[model samples]
Target chain A: MTPAFEKLQKQLRQLPGLGFRSAERIALHLLVEKPARLPELVEALQAAAATVRRCPRCGNLAEDGLCAICADERREQGVVCVVEHVPDLVAMERSGAYRGVYHVLHGRLSPIQGVRPEDLNFEALFSRVADGGVRELILALSNDVEGEATCHYLTQHLPAPANGVEVKTTRIGFGLPSGGGVLYADSVTLKSALDGRRHYE
Target chain B: MTPAFEKLQKQLRQLPGLGFRSAERIALHLLVEKPARLPELVEALQAAAATVRRCPRCGNLAEDGLCAICADERREQGVVCVVEHVPDLVAMERSGAYRGVYHVLHGRLSPIQGVRPEDLNFEALFSRVADGGVRELILALSNDVEGEATCHYLTQHLPAPANGVEVKTTRIGFGLPSGGGVLYADSVTLKSALDGRRHYE
Candidate 1:
C-alpha cells in the first residue's frame, strides 16, 4: 500500500463503526473503484463542516441561528420534548408520535462520567421555559438510571410557569416495543409494562 | 436534519457497506460528538486524492510511478501474481505467502457488466511479460466462473516467452481453508479439496 492510501485508511478507521478492514475497503472504493466520487464526498464534508452548527435553542444540527424545528411556526410552541441526543429527537420525529418542539440535552446525567448540569444544553431550555409560552415538558429521555436522575434534576430546578401556572412534566413509557415478543423483554421493561398496564378492550 | 447534515450523510451512504442509519451515525459523530477529528479526516482524504495513483507496472496503488512492492529490489519480479483487485493484492501481501510482485487486473471479465479485456490492466501485464524478465505467472483470481474465464483468456493471449523459454502458468488451488472443518465446508469446496488431496504422511 502507498503512504497516502495507508494514511487515508488510518483516518477512516477512527470514524464511528468503521474497523480496519471496512476502512481499507472504503479507502479503496473511493480511490481505486470510484475515484470520481471522491471529490463529491470531499466537497460534501467540507460544506457540512463549514455550515453545520448547533441549534441555539435546541442543540440540534443547524445551518444558521436556530434549527428548522425551532424556527417552524406550525410546530407546537407550548410543548417541548426533552431528549438525550439529536438521534433520539430524530427517532421521535420518525415515529410521527410527537408534534411538539424538542430540546436536545446532548447527553444525560452521568455522574460516573462526570457530566453535570452545566455540561448539557440546560440553560437555553430553562430560558425557553421561563419565556412563558411552554405549558408542558415531556421527558423523552432513555429509560435508564441516568435518565431518571436527569428527569429528577430538571423537575427540581424548573422555574414557575410564566403565567404562574403549573408546568406538567411527564416521562415516556417503557415496555415491550411494538412487534416485540414478551420472551425477549428484559425484567425492568416487563416490570414497567406490568405496572403501567392499560385497560384493554 | 439540516441541509448540510443530510448532504454529508448522503455522501457517506455512498461508501461501501454503509447504510443510511450508519451513515447518519457517522455524520453525527463527526460533526457533533468529535468535531475536532473532522479536519484531520478531510486533510487525509485530500492528501490521498492528490498523491496516490496506480503503479504503472502492476496497477497497484502508488504515490509516484511505482508501488512499494515493485520498487523494492528484493521482491521477485520474475514471478508475477495476478489478482482481480487491489484489495485482493493487499490480502495476499498480508498473508505473507508469496515473495513475488503482483499485477492488479482491477476487475475480472463480467459480460453482464460489460467489462472487457481493454477495460482492465492486461495490456501493461502483457508488456511486462513480453519485455523478458518473467519466468512464471500465478493466477490468484476468484474461484467463480469469471475468474476461470479470465485465466483462460490470459493463457490464450500470452505472448511467447521473450527469452524463448516456456512460462509456467498456474492457478491457485481451491480447497478447504486452513482451520476449517470438513463438515462445515461447502460442497464445491469439499469437491475441490478432495480432487486436490495429497498423500498422507
Candidate 2:
C-alpha cells in the first residue's frame, strides 16, 4: 500500500466500529462525496481539535477555557448533574429537561482496568463540593457495575448525608409497556412488573 | 442548549451511523475515554483530508498525482480491473490476490438517481484503451443491479472480443459455513450458491 493509503487506513482503524472494510468505505466516501468538502472537513477537524477544551468548572467542552454550560447564566449553578462521560451530558441535554450544569467524570472506576480515584477528577470534584455553594449533586452514572462502584467511591468523598448537602443518584424509569401481554414475559421482568405495581386512584 | 454542545451535536449527527444516540455516544467518547485520542483523531482527519487526492490516470486516491497501483512498475501493464469505486479497489488489494492496475468509475449508471455516462470517466477509459497496450478489462463492480447495468454499458464501449482484449467479470466467493444448513440461507445467497456450484469430478 502507498504511504497515504496506509496512513489513512491506520488512522481510520482507530475509530469505533471501523474495520478494514469500513475504513476503506469511509476513505472512498471522503474521496468521492463532494471532494471539495474534504478540505472543509479537514478545516473543521483541525478547528475542533485546536479549540475544543474542557470547562474547568463543569468539564463540558468549550472553545474558550470555560465551557458554554459554565458560562451560561441561566443554568442552575448549585445543582450539578455528575455523569461518567460527555455523551451522558448530551443525552441529558437532549431530553431538554435538565436546567443544571454537568460535571463529566470522563470514566468510571474498574479495578480490572486499574483505574484509580486519582486517575479521575475526583479531587477537583471534592474541591467543587467543599467550596460550599453547590446544594445538590445528582449522580447520573449508568446503572452498570462500574457505574455503581464509581458512585459508591464518589459518595465516600462527599460531605456526610446530614451535612445539609443532598447527594441524589438517578436511574432510568423502565418497565413493561402499558397494555402489553404477560404471556411472553420472562421471570425477572415479570417479577419487576409485580414488584413495581402501584395503586390506582 | 449551549451553542458549543448544539454545534458539536450537528457535526456528529452528520457522521455515518450517528443518530441522536450515536452522536451523543461519540460526544461522550470525546469528553471521556482517552480524550487525548479525540484531538489526535481530529488532527489525523484534517491531515488525511489535506493530503489525499485522486490519481489522474485511474481516479484512485493518490498521495501524489498517481496512485500506488498506477505508479508501480511491476504491475501487469495489459490488465486493468474496472471498479465502480475506490473502496472496491482497496478490498481487492486487501486479499493480496491481484497485482494489477485499477480504473475507478467513481459511480455507476443509475437512471433513478440521474447518474449518466458523462458523469463517469468513460471517455478517459476509452482513450486509455485506444492508446493501446491494455489487453484485458476485468469488471469488478458490485453484485447489485446497478453494477450489472454498468458492466453491460462498459462492455458496449470496448473493442469486440476479436480485438485481443478479453472482457471478464468476477464475483466474490461465498458459501455456507461447513456446519451450516440450507434453511438459514437468504434468497439471493441461495441463488448465488446454485450459480457458483462446481462439478465434483
Candidate 3:
C-alpha cells in the first residue's frame, strides 16, 4: 500500500472497536462520498473537545464549569449518586427514575495497575461531602472488583455525620432466574447461594 | 433523557454500523477516559479531515492534487483499473496485484438510491479515454448488480479511440471454484457458464 493509505489505516485502527475491516469501510466511505459529511464530524469533535469540561465539584462532563445537574437549582441537594464514570451517570439518567446530583469517579481503584487512593478524585468527593449539604452519599459504583475496592476506600474516607446524614452502598440484588441450573453454578455463586438461601416452604 | 443526552444518541446513530448499544459503549469510553485522550482523538479527526483530499483526475484520496498512482512514473499508462470507490482501489493496491493507474467512479449506478449515470465521475473517464493514451479499461467494479450496470453504461459512453489506442471492456473472470458445486449457482452464473461452455470429445 502507498504511504497515504498506510497512514490512514494506522490512524483508523486507533478508534475504539474499529478493526481493519471497519477502518477500510470508513476510509472508503470518505473517499467515495466526496466526504461532505467529514467537516461536520470534525467540527463536532472539536466542539465537544473544547466545551466539554469536568465539573469542578462533581467531576462529571459539563459544557461549563458546573454540570447541568449541579447548575440546576431544582434538583435535590440532599442526595448524591456516586458513579465510576459519566456514562454511568448518563445511564442512570436514561432510566428517568433518579433526579439527584452525581459525582463521577473517572475510574475505579485497581492495585494491580498501581492506582492508589490518591490517584482518583477522592479529594473532590471528600470536599463535596464535608460541606454536610448532602443527607445521603449513595455508593452506586459497579459490582466489579475495582468498583468494590473503590467503594470500600470511599466509605473509610467519608466521615459519618452523627447527625441525620446516611452513608450507604447501593447494589443490584442477585437471585436465581426462573429457569437457571444449579449444576452449572460457579464456586463464588454457589457460596452466595448458601449465604442468601430462601425457604420455598 | 436530557437534551444533551438525546443529541449524543442522535450523533452516534449517524456513524456507520453503530447501533444504540455500541454508541453507548463508545460514549462511555470517551467520557470515562482522561480529558487528555479526548483532545487527542478530536485533534486526529480534525487533522485527517483537513489534510485528506480527492485527486482531481482519478478521484482517489490524496494529500496533494494528484494521487501517487496517477503521478507515478512506473505504472502502466495503457491500462486503467475502473472501480466504484477509492477504497476498492486501495484494497486492490494493498494486495500488491494491480500495477496500473485507477479511475474511481465515486459510486455505482444504484437506481434505488437515486444514483444516476451523471452522478458519477464519468466525464473524467471519457476525457481520459478520448486522449488516446489508454489501451484497456479494466472493469474492476464489484460483482454486484449496480456495478454491472455501471460497467455497461461506461461501455456505451466509450467511443472508438482517435489514435492507434485500443479500447476494450476487460473483466476479471469468475468461474466455479476448484472444489465447488455448479448446479447450486444462480441464473447469472448459469448464463456465464453457458456462454463460455467448453467443447469436449
Cα RMSD to native, each candidate? 6.2, 8.5, 7.6
Model 1 lDDT tens row, B60-156: 9998788999999999989898888887777667655578898999998989899999998899989888888788787766666787788889988
**Which model scores highest in DockQ?**
1
Alpha carbon deviation, residue A164, candidate 1 (Å): 1.5
Q: Where does candidate 2 clash, by residue pair? A: A87-B28
RMSD of 1: 6.2
In model 2, where do residues sit more than 4 Å from their true spots?
A63-77, A93-101, A108-119, A141-201, B1-5, B70-76, B91-100, B109-118, B140-201
User: Which tens-of-lDDT digit does each residue in B1-201 have in candidate 2?
Assistant: 345445565665665445775555555455445567666666666667767777788887877677878888999866787777765566566545566788888888999999999999787677667766576666655556787678778767765443555444443325533333332344465445435633220
Deviation (Å) of B173 in candidate 3:
5.3
Question: Against the true structure, what is model 1's DockQ?
Answer: 0.75
Cα lDDT, all candidates: 0.80, 0.63, 0.65
DockQ of 3: 0.31
What would the per-residue lDDT of candidate 3 be over residues A24-63, giving only the tens digit for each residue? 6665554345367555555655556556677898887777
**For residues A87-172, what per-residue lDDT tens digits would candidate 1 score against the true structure?**
66766666555578989899988889999999989988988888877787877666667877888899888877677766777665
Query: Model 2 chain A: which ten-residue window has the lowest total lDDT?
Result: A176-185
lDDT of 3 at B134: 82
lDDT of 2 at A81: 74
User: What residue pairs clash in candidate 1, if any at all?
Assistant: none
Q: For candidate 2, write residues A136-192 as lDDT tens digits.
A: 676666556777688788877675443556555343223444433232334454445
Minimal lDDT window, size 10, model 1 chain B = B192-201
Comparing 1 with 3 on lDDT, the higher-scoring candidate is 1
